[model samples]
Target chain A: MTFVTITFFLFLAVAFLCYFVMPKQHRWLVLLAFSIAFYLFAGWEKFLFVLASALIAYLVGRKGTKSSLVFGIVSIVLLLFYAKAGNSILAAFQMKESIIVPLGISYYSFSIIGYMLDVYYKKIECEKNFFAFLLYMIYFPQILEGPIPRYKKLAPQLMEGHEFSYERFCFGAQRALWGYFKKLVIADRIALYTGEVFSNYKDYSGIYFFVAVLLSSLQLYTDFSGCMDIALGVSQCFGITLDENFRRPFFSKNAAEFWRRWHITLGTWFKDYVYMHLAIHPKLLKLSKLAKDKVGKRFGKSLITIIPLAVVWLLTGLWHGTGADYILWGCYWGIIIILSTVFAKEWKQVNQFLKIDGNSKGFSRFQMIRTFFVFSGARLLTAPGDLKVSAYMFRHMFSLWSFREFFTKGALVGILSVWDVVIVIIGTLILWKVDLLQEQGVEIRKKIGQYPIPLRWVFYYGLFFATLVFGIYGPGYQASDFVYIQF
Target chain B: MEEEILELLSAEFPEVDFTASDELVDDGLLDSLTITGIIATLSMEYDIEIPYEEIIEENFNSIAGLASMVERLQEN
Candidate 1:
């Protein structure tokens, strides 16, 4: 069940009660049961995929052989590949209908494989208990989408039954409420505009496309990060601390730093497992040496680094989807990062020669704004089904034709009213304020907690009533699913 | 040994006082990119092959840790 629905809250409430009420030793068992129930609630047919994955990982982790590790890793990758790409393969064979790609397959597959690999490398001990491993694989909060927790990080917390603490519960509840506010008030409202323009780009051009596309970046950030907040918040109520996924990504000064801040778990996963491994692999070392001799040092190092980076980005793209546009978007980012790395020294030198104070606050702001636009522009490739449509929209954006139509009330009020626009602006400003506070290392939740009871109650109830009133929910509007869930 | 490691770190990241903090990795002093650059330079300068398994926080958290890690690797 999605987080927005009443059914999910009901499920969480029941699960929470069962967890606390059960005998201490059996609390973990209760979680396992609830996780299974949550999975089954999504679909009974997909239950087998999760179970099989857990079983394979557990068995292979126990074996801990070179061949077994290879087999286990390969099996998981193949399973993920087939689930993701199976339909396209069947279409080539002239099949009438394609199979459904199971939910959480991409996410759970990575978590499981990471566990087995850790076992293989002796980073963590093998999980001997099948049930514990299964619970780790299918924890309901992270199952839909993930910050992609490692076994070492998540498994022990699941086993350590937590005593109910009022402080923890309040923090988690407030966090979840914040998530709901962002998802409903900000993300969903903007989705009405972005969803319209992306689907039917031909109907409008110039500023309409510009506004929708730019706002889409904000919509995506709030939606995905909002889901993360809810997931992490729910886990926190259970006294589990999942690794954080975002860290004020918009404040990053460059593309490299932006990626490091955004989706931190996934980036670290690829870094630890894929990029770093290949960077130091024997074959790559030999290649780097040969390239160093054949070409200049800078060129050679770039050549070696570029290959693994390209692989990571390509897989990152495919992980999003098998679509050509996704692949193009991946390469676009890969190129940007690679260019930055290769010319980093020269770029610094050029800035210094030009007497630019790269460390100054003004320069930092300029960099942030530049990075934001570049990131938004790259998102255009992801918004449209066809790359040509993105190109057309971009062309119209630059053409300045019919630009006067942009500021007119007629265009802006088509999807949402002026009041709706005002709400969105205010909501965005709040989000920005919160992120800025976090970037400056302010403990906002703790600060809120320090307030007197009356003020605290006022703060909490104010948010609750505001969400109830202003949230984009009603009989006509279906709650849009979190964007990252598809991945 | 600490001084040698400090010299290496200073050459790589001139902005940070590497010796001031023992928790270089724990603090925000050394990022992943800087860590990778240090590893590459150490590998080349010392003629030591630091494998992926050795690239852990414990081995690179401070000048002393880094020096000790390099000495152990060199001996091996």
Candidate 2:
């Protein structure tokens, strides 16, 4: 069930009540029961798959010693591959119909694999309690989309004694309300415009298509990060901490920094589990040394680093979907980042040598704005269906056309009002400011809470009321699903 | 030996102070890949094989903890 649905809130309230009312030792059992029930409520067919996977992982993890842990690891990996890569495998089998992916399979599979790997490595001891282990894997708050919880981080909290706290509930509710506002107001509104432009790219030209791409990026960020906020806020009510997944990625100075901020858990997962391992390979090291000696230090670093980055980005693209466009999108990012890194030192030198208004604040601000547009242009490649369509869109975007006609279009104006655009810009700025403050080690919620009751309540009520009045909700509007859920 | 290890970390990540009591893994000071790098380096430099299973946070919780693990491996 969606977080926005009335049924979900009803289920949450009932579960919350039962959980706090239960005796201290039995609280975990209450949570486990609710989690299973919730999963079954969403889809009964998929519940079986989740159970089987969890059981297999737990049993193998418990039985296998460190030396024999490969069996458990392999089993988990194969299951994950089968579930996640089912469509590709089915295509190979010459199946015609679209293969149904089990909901949350990608997320929970990773969590299960991470748990098994941690257990095998003895980073965390194997949980003898089956119920607690099951609860960790199937926790309802995180089951749909995840801040994929690590066993070491979450298991203790599951086992910990609980007492209902008014403060925690208030904080979680406020956060959830804010998340809903982002999803309904900013993201959904922007999606209306982007959806129209992208659906008929051939019709739009010049700045119209370019504007859509820039807006699509914002819509995506708000939609995906909004879901994460809801997930985190819901989990917080249970006193379970899920990882913060996004950090104002739009404000990042470079593509690499953007990856660090966006879908943080997934990026870190790839870095820890894939990229780092390849980087430290004996073959890679030897090649790095050879290149450095034969060519030059600059070329060597570029060659060595760029190869791994390319592979990582290629996998990242493929992981998003089986589409060629996704693959191209991934490579597009890979090229941008690699080139940026390659010329980084030289770029700095050029900046120094030219001294072209280098000291002026206005010049630096202009450069930042230029970089943002450049990044958005590269991201347009991510939206098209194939290379042909992508090229067509690019051609239209650059073609010398009637600028007056584009601005005067009624459909464009109808889809996104002047006030709606203004609201999106303001909302994005506020979100970025909050993220920047947090990055600098400031706790925003804590500071906000510390404000006098009248001021704090006013801010809360204002946010809630604005969401109620301005938020997009109707028969035709599909609650835009979180983008990363496809992965 | 501990001072040498600290020196290596200090050179690698100059942002933080490497200390005897710091919980590298638990406190998020050092990520999993960095730990793997340290393990690989230690294996090569000391002619000691650090088993993957033994690369848990307990062994590398602190400088003293890591030193003790290395000392034990040397004894073996």
Candidate of highest lDDT: 1
**In candidate 2, how many Å is residue A107 off?**
1.1
- The lDDT values for all models are 0.85, 0.75
Candidate 2, residue B38: lDDT: 63
**A1-487, model 1: which lDDT tens digit per residue?**
8999888999999999999998887899988999899889878878988888889999999999989989999999988888878887899899989776667898899898889888888899999899999999999889988989899989999999999988998899898888888999999999988888878877777778888778988998999899989999998898888989999899999999999999988898888888877776656656666777898666655655688788889988888878788899889999999889878889999999999999999999999999898889888988766788888888887555475666564346677777788889999999999999988999889988999989989989988887788889878778999999878
Model 1 residue A58 distance off true place after TM-score fit, in angstroms: 1.2
What ranges in model 2 sit over 4 Å off? A65-75, A83-85, A88-96, A281-310, A335-351, A354-378, A385-387, A400-403, A410-414, A436-442, B1-76
Interface C-alpha root-mean-square deviation of candidate 2: 5.0
Worst 10 residues of 1 chain A by lDDT: A403-412
Candidate 1: pairs in clash: none
- Backbone clashes (count) for model 2: 0
Error of 2 at B18 (Å): 7.4
As a whole number from 0 to 100, the lDDT of residue A19 in candidate 1 is 91
